[model samples]
Target chain A: MSIPDTTLASAKALVAPVLDDTSRAQIRAERMSAFVRYTLLITVGFLMLYPLLWLVGASFKTNSEIFGSIGFIPQEPTLDGYRKGWETSTPYTFGRFFWNTFLIILPKTIFTAISCALVAYGFARFEFPYKKLLFASLIATLLLPNVVTRIPQYILFRDLGWLDTYLPLWVPSAFAGDAFFVFMLVQFLRAIPRDMEEAARVDGANSLQTLIYIVVPMLMPALISVALFQFMWTMNDFLGPLIYLSSVQSFPVSLALKLSIDTTEAFDWNRILAMSVLALLPALIVFFMAQRYFIEGISTGGVKG
Target chain B: MARLQIRNLEKTYTNTFKAVHGINLDVADGEFMVLVGPSGCAKSTTLRMIAGLESISGGEVVIGDRVVNRLQPGERGIAMVFQNYALYPHMKVRKNLSFGLRLQRAPKAEIERKTAEVARILEIEPLLDRLPKELSGGQAQRVALGRALIKQPEVFLFDEPLSNLDAKLRASMRVRITDLHKRLKDQGMSSTVIYVTHDQTEAMTMGDRICVMKDGHIMQVADPKTLYDRPANAFVAGFIGSPEMNLIAGRLDGNSFHLGAQSLVLPDELMARLRANSGSVTLGIRPQHLRVNTADGLRAVVAGAEFMGHEVVLHLDVEGERVVAVLPAADYADLDRGTTVTLTPDPGQAHVFDQSGGNISLSTSQ
Candidate 1:
């Protein structure tokens, strides 16, 4: 019995090395697969980002060198594009157009945040007469196409003698006219518990005071998301300003950028690209600064509600 | 501190479902009254109506001398602590405590003093600068309590404030809250409190007087001792105790109570206390009062025996009905299942109920 047990122990020792060898091979294969996966992902990610990179790089290139080669690298780098772009073909520089854009965006973003929050709070919390009908109509507006309302809205603004002013651009937003934003905020508000609001009421705060003190602070993340979206969308809007502001001085960056392309006989590709890169900066910077809240707001609003 | 009078309060939803059916309760100043019931019994709804948070459908809520059915919750001079400890998530503990004072436009120095005082009372001074998210569950609860206490409202409403805590923490917080109430009363402050909870242990331990509710109606309002000793109905009998009072369906005739084929002679004291003499009845016996292995009693088979350290709970099957008896551990070493035994219920502690569920064995002298 002792001799047989020694033989069994030797046999077990022989099998242990083989098992270890197989596991080592498996580890090697897993490492190789992970390397291949990361390589493929990096290649695809860079491919998607190449256009933006090329735009930024080409912005620094001389006008002659911009279309001369497919390579993004500038053989001759110069600030001539920005220099000429800053002094637009029109009398007002790009600074004036940027300032004009800011004027339109400030009130529009601020008003959208405040008005949508109020409307969303009412819809989410209170029960009023015809509440269901009113809410259904509000959601119906969400499904309605923007083009369907553009003509009637333009006619209304024209009759009001508001066609040549920024009032036509931002006044509607102050009244919670953006149904999409109102819907977003309403869905977000629905996900939040109402105990805090009730506590505020029990603490002797009236309805308006509750809205201002408790509701607004808790709604900050979603409100920031709303403001960010409104800011970026208004900054990039071309048709609204083009239809309303015919004056050269009143034109925003969007229409002003178009004016550069339209007035000149030969298109200055480098200058347009440079101005486009500059126009994209504000939205990009603001988004990065508020990236955490923007993601949190959207995810919580969508998933929970 | 002011008395709260809820008169014929009703709550009917838009779907025409009546959740609260005109219940009346009067909480005296400085009394810690608890409204307790199982889920869907509208205890929270009743408390909300008193706080002026829910609209009164058919009754008046009087705080102090004023009818506050038309007043806002804030204007009703009341404060509430929610089950979730509804501290303003953004505000620090100090700001949360002073929010009511700030809303009232009180003097800054007064707000500071009141905030500090409340923080100290709740032992949350060290947590004053921390946001609600930073505090632990127990700490957050204390901060929520301070928020209510700082208001010093005429009445305080608590909606299962400690139900979220673990068992051990819940026990500790229960004592803390009752102590706080006593301290406030001793200081001559207006400390009328209406607390709502579904946990019977919380209702039994903390309430000055408990109001048991069922199906949107009050079952009994009595002190914990009286509620245990003399329940008004079968529902109250089964609800208030931990192991629950075993209610056996039987008949009482002459001086004997019949359990199916078996019967036991009723004591003169129990017979004298009986309001109904001869009819179908429920014989209510608490587990502690049921004696096992008695010579002259109802014969039963031991279905199960649970060793609970100091005591053993014997689950017995008497004929076809289930009965439980609590016995001292020393009395029974290890009683095996299927063993035959006899359960003798103490006559003085037994209760008899008529068909309509009213306790018929309650003596008017008690």
Candidate 2:
């Protein structure tokens, strides 16, 4: 092959070899695709992150600045909200609210882990009569509205004379297991090939033995994933706390955060936002702390459905 | 270690698909019994039934003196290594090894001893502390084996344990597993081992007795050499060898038989059988049995030849029928395609089967 007789200037003046229709269309399509992707991503990302950013911004703002306009940064930032939200609030202090919530959610999380894991183990490994039917029932509970359970549960609690205590939320977790959590665990369990369990069985492992030694360990990602999920969910649950408890003294952080909403307290924006940020602490700490486990778990067979 | 007997075992699912039809097999103590077939032949299902993993739908699995039909796998004294090397993913190799011991509530020191011994035996000591993810495929398989070995079960069941390994590793592991069986036998641990594999090489290389299966039915049960040399049916003959046995179609008429357009005389006994019996008979010949030579013999055309270092595989056109023939390197050094060659099958090397694929004695093969 020999070069065409063309000068550098002539080559420079040429029209990029007059790209074939295929290459021209490909280049145009690639550029259009890149533009659309970024536009969609940034637009949706901005919308999702906007409210969290606003909440953080409000946490630092004074009452005056908060009411003025929504901005990323306050004109004159102040720590009065933090002071008031953290310690200077009303009848039920945020510290006490924090303690109460900590006390309840802590026990609730542990109970949820235990009950969910045990029930999940049963659903995952065992093959008794009505096994599939039992599993189906557990999954069915996840679809029913939470409000439907509220009235009947409240009546049961009313008859038991337990309304202003954390027993209502924490006790149930010890009994029937979190259906959603169990479902996630069951998926993870199912993914573990039966060979492992069979190997264990030959090794003298009965059903419970297999569950504890082989099956449970393989499902760590899913279990920790569910535990983390449960921690965040229970920490932020307000409706359950509201309906079950009456006294402000026994309120969780979520119910405490809503205290401003209940009282005629000038709609305490500074305190509400500060407490909102504070309420996020458990979720954030939980998510960040177990985030790697969380991601690993969900990316595993952490039955998202 | 004990004798294992599967007496008319069956497996039927809720969908009413009977994966394993009722089949009976016996494994003598210390014998390596291989159940081999193509995929979906229920060889694995049959193994699972013996392992107490699949609920036996209709019959009892007897091990030693006890019938283990209702026993859990743990209680059945059977250990199984699976096709996927299903080690517990979150557990370390040590944990995987000791899991069964721990389940039995064995003392810590004993569990440690056995775990160490098996890891040493499998050459997986360095992997004891690493999780399943951290180990290589071969190491994970060793850990799965170690887990089963540590249990000290009476029967060792392997469900294509080498299927997950690469070819090189598979060959190496095959040797190791065979050595382990030999060592176990020498130590007087008379366990009846049942191995399930689709790979004919594994079955041929490892099994004391290979039970060739098809569509949930046992085609034949014979020692490896016998299975290879005298397969009971067309499926077994074709399935047992890599290049496969060649099956050529022919017909009977008077003294000479007609194959394509050529005439070949039958053995006097075969002619006598045709005179006595009824219907058509099929002739089966292994690839190695049919050789192309320059001597006066059965005539064939040279189709093609594949040169393997130690040997060459010649694809011969035997009267318009393509059949593979293996020759030693020296004989195939200069064999060419399209040339006329004399073909010869070693007497007593070919098997005769009826049209239904059942083997027949030469005296009755019609």
What are the per-residue Cα lDDT tens digits for candidate 2 across A1-305?
76666775587567555656668899999999999999999999999999998998988898878778968688778888888777634675788988988898888888887788889878777778999898888889999888788889899988998888888888998875578888877788777667677777766777777777766776777878877887888887878898888888888788887777777458778888988988887789778988888899988663221
Estimate, for each residue in B150-225, the C-alpha lDDT of model 1 and write its tens digit: 9888898999999888988999999999999999999998899999999999999999999999988999999999
lDDT at B44 for candidate 2?
89
lDDT of 2: 0.80
Candidate 1, which CAPRI tier?
A: medium
Runs in model 2 lying further than 4 Å from the true structure? A1-65, A68-78, A87-92, A119-140, A175-178, A261-268, A302-305, B253-256, B268-278, B291-299, B318-320, B332-336, B342-344, B362-366
> How many clashes (backbone N, Cα, C below 3 Å) per candidate?
1, 0
**Model 1 chain B: lowest-lDDT 10 consecutive positions:** B324-333
**Top model by DockQ, which number?**
1
lDDT of 2 by residue, B1-366 (tens): 488887887889979998877788888988999999999999988988888788888877999989999888888888889888777776677887887677778999998898889889889888888978887788878887787778777888999999878999999999999898898788887557899999999999988999998888888999998787767788898899879888876765564545777755555554454432334666677888875673555688778889998889888887778888888988676887888777756656766667787766333332
lDDT of 1 by residue, A173-272 (tens): 9989899988988888887888998999999888888999988888888898999999999999988999889998999999988999999999998899
The per-residue C-alpha lDDT of model 2 at residue A225 equals 84
